[model samples]
Target: MNVNGTLINYYFHCKRQCYFHGNRLNLEDNSENVSIGKALHEERNKCNNTEIEIENIKIDKLTKEYLIEVKKSDADVEAAKWQLLYYLKVLKNKGILRKGKLEFIEKNKTKKKILLFELTEENEKELCEITNNIKKLILQDDIPKVLNESKCKKCAYYEYCYI
Candidate 1:
């Protein structure tokens, strides 16, 4: 199975979510927040000069120096960061090297955000470990535990997990 950027993001955000998605129990289509995010992604791609897609991964905008990821919000910035880093690793395996930029179109209450990252030896090693772990997690017979955090209130899987 291919480990796309979404899996990487979900692995960091919520293991149960990652496992559900990896196992093909998709709930994104039933989510209002997901709809908003998709709309934001469509808007972000409207004027981009170049967008590259590989399997399930989509690079929102690419430039000579950067592989860009556009996000609707910064609520899950760490997940977004790792997703972009995984994209960089994918390109590197194909002999293409570029930095990564995470762009949030809509700022959260406290701050505006635009972050840049580069793939390093350390990042590659960690991501490889994450990739393997995710592979194992998805194949397990049982779903991972629900996190039940404040974020769960907004998750698409909230009803499935709680009710």
Candidate 2:
């Protein structure tokens, strides 16, 4: 399966999540968190008709200076960042270079509301390895160990991991 933005985001947020999504065992449709996020995404995309979908990538907005990604919350900044980075990579590969702008529509007691990213050589190198790792991870016979963190409770795959 192609490693899309969701897979990249899940890989950083939770390894098991990435594995489940990569292996095509999706259960996100039942989660309230996913629903809320999708609602936010739809609302944003509705305005200006900024959503651009190409292959497996759906960018929120693409401007001369930035390729914007709108997130419902800043719950997992790293996950969002990597997802945006992957999008940047995709654009770069297509000869369309632009910086990444992450806009969090909701904040969770965090001071950060907006973040910017540029595709550095180091990040690009790491991304290459990350994609390969994800491919191998999903192909494994055994599932990844469930993370017992508090975030697991809010994850869509909570029941699969905990119950």
Off by over 4 Å in 2: 107-112
Tens-place lDDT per residue, model 2, 1-163, is 9888999999999999999999889999999989988887787677778899977999999999999998877889999999999999999999999999998876454554799999999999999999999899989998999999999989999998878
lDDT of 1 at 139: 92
The residue pairs found clashing in candidate 2 are: none
Stretch of 10 with least lDDT, candidate 2: 104-113
RMSD (CA, Å), candidate 1 to true, equals: 1.9
Which regions of candidate 1 fall more than 4 Å away from where they truly are?
A: 107-111
Give the per-residue lDDT of model 1 (tens digit) for 6-119: 899999999999999999999999999898888766765676546678756778877889998877778899899999999998888888899999977674545547899999
Best by lDDT: 2
